[model samples]
Target: MPVRYLIVDDEEPGRINLRLALADYPDWQLVAECDGNAAARAALARHDVDVIFLDVQMPGETGLVLARELACLCEPPLIVFVTAFSAHAVDAFEVHALDYLLKPLDDTRLAHAVERAAAMLRQRQREAYGAALRDYAVAGAAPYPERIGVRSVGRIEQVVVDEILWMEAAGNYVELHLPARTVLHRITLNRLEALLDPARFLRVHRGAIVRRDQIASLATGGEGSHRLALRCGGVVPVSGSYLAALKAAMAF
Candidate 1:
């Protein structure tokens, strides 16, 4: 059987370009194309796809968020993140993603990613599975915080993870929030999430992640959407798709 595949990116042109690039790969069937994380999530729940060409940055839920969820499945498809951002490469490999493809969708690169996906599907090593679990545990460590190195003026500074109130993506850099300070780092929010404790730090929006203790309350607005009000009085909008997870986290 042809390797069933799903292409997920918010950009229509990017998706179309990827399809065109994969035209020669007859062994890889283009099973679905999803514009956003919600659509991709729905498709994954219903399909038995072999691989996914995912874009890391999207409007609502990011590819990383979807990837983490997929990792919980019995047989998660091989993930190849198709992203314009290169800063996330380290984090991608940490989560055991099959490969990473830079955007603008190079034909050669796409073909290589597809080939890697094929190899992963065939072998499906238990070591890779164990590595993925180890990555998740290391990434999700909480309560006792670790020191994250950050570059300050002239030199690097070690910041305690627990002091973080929230993080916001600002173009190529991520803004780290704390009780009395806010600093900018060269890393993207996606990369930062992979290093933070998921139980204590929840991504409430596409561009933001908040520490659970820092969240003052969650307010529901029109159309069933929610907004996270932080102890600092900063508010971040939460999409409907992630509302369930947030509500569950806040419960008890």
Candidate 2:
């Protein structure tokens, strides 16, 4: 059987271009094309694709978010992130994505990714699977809530995980929101999500995660999108990519 592949990108042109490039591979089957994370999730749930060509930046749910979920699947497809952002290469490798392709993707790179996917699919070892995940966990360095250390001015301050209200990404640094005050921490949202307990801190957006108890309300935005109104009077826009999980988390 040919290797089944799924192409996921928010841009119609990118998707079409990838499809056109892949047309040269007689052994590859274009199983599906998803415009965003929601469609990709639905297709993954219903199909038996062997690999995915995923775009990192989208309007709502990021390619990374979908990759995390796919990692939990019984037989997850090989992930080759297709994105314009080269800055996330380290993060992508850390997440154990098969390959990272830049925008205006080249046929040579696509072929290389396909070849890597083939090699990975043929591997018989399961031990290496957990190793990649372990590396990824460390690569995406998220602070452990039970024991989090923050830097306030020139002093190293420690804050318990449970006391956190929410976190926001500010360039290379993160703003840690607490009940009494907000503190600045040097961490990426991707790394932070890996450390925090998912049950306690729900990622409502690409750059924000709120403690479940800190959410004030979920207000509907125009179209099918939603926004999370925090207890601190801050609103976090929920992407359509993550709306399903967010709704399930809130039992809405």
Candidate 3:
């Protein structure tokens, strides 16, 4: 199967150049292109992109800030920072699924990054499968994972589960949202739900699970649903499918 990719750069020339370079690899497909961080995020929401070739410098939101936000995505795309910046910026990317290519991306370097991304994506699939099996086998397993592991930059980061404000599903992974950081964990929401304390966390939507105490307000969301406003100012959508559970939790 061809790997779907996204290109995000403020400069039309940069986007064009990347497009031309990517054409050499027939196995990779360009699914979308965005001019800024907001556009890139919107594109991601509308399409399933496996990799993102991003520019670090832009007018409004820089690529580094966008990368941090992307890190929180459930199944974040492989982020390749296509920038002219020096190696110092490498530190910021070290905590997420990322690669860096100095300005004027080379075919050889791009090929190497693509190869590594393929291996990472494959490993992610295996991890998701194993997680589902483990979840099915354990009915009431205690002692859940103390630290959730997430890939960042070029290393694995362990995030404390207790600090997570909520979790949301994104494709094959889970987004663990914290007060200060969002970690993209390579695990299914179903598999993760089993490990959390039921009393503290509640499934508010098929794609979302939030800490009970973290909810700030629950209001009619229109269309027979509820919108849970969090203390952090992020609102989570609650579908009718989970309305009963959400209401019951609020009553507690």
Over 48-165, each residue of candidate 1 has an lDDT whose tens digit, in order, gives: 8877889989987888787777666655676777877755454544333336788676777676667656765666642454345334434443332265545332223446677888
Cα lDDT tens digits for candidate 3, 1-252: 788999999999999989999898898999988999999889888998888888989998988677666554555676778888754344223222246677787889788777766766666643432232232223213345444546543334556667889999999788889998788876568767766668778898989999888877789855666799998878999888888887787786
Give all TM-scores, in the order shown.
0.51, 0.52, 0.49
What is candidate 3's CA lDDT for residue 169?
Answer: 99
Off by over 4 Å in 3: 94-97, 125-252
In model 2, the worst 10-residue window by lDDT is: 124-133
Q: Candidate 2 on 1-252: residue-level lDDT in tens?
A: 788899999999999999999899898999889999999989878888877899989987888788777665545666778877755454445234235788878878788777766665666322344344333434456533354544322223456678888888898677888888988875578866776778788887888888888877888867777889888777888887777788787773
Ranking by lDDT: 3, 2, 1
Scored by CA lDDT, what does every candidate get?
0.72, 0.72, 0.72
lDDT over C-alpha atoms for residue 171 of model 3: 90
Cα deviation of 226, candidate 3, in Å: 68
Backbone clash count for every predicted candidate, in the order shown:
0, 2, 7
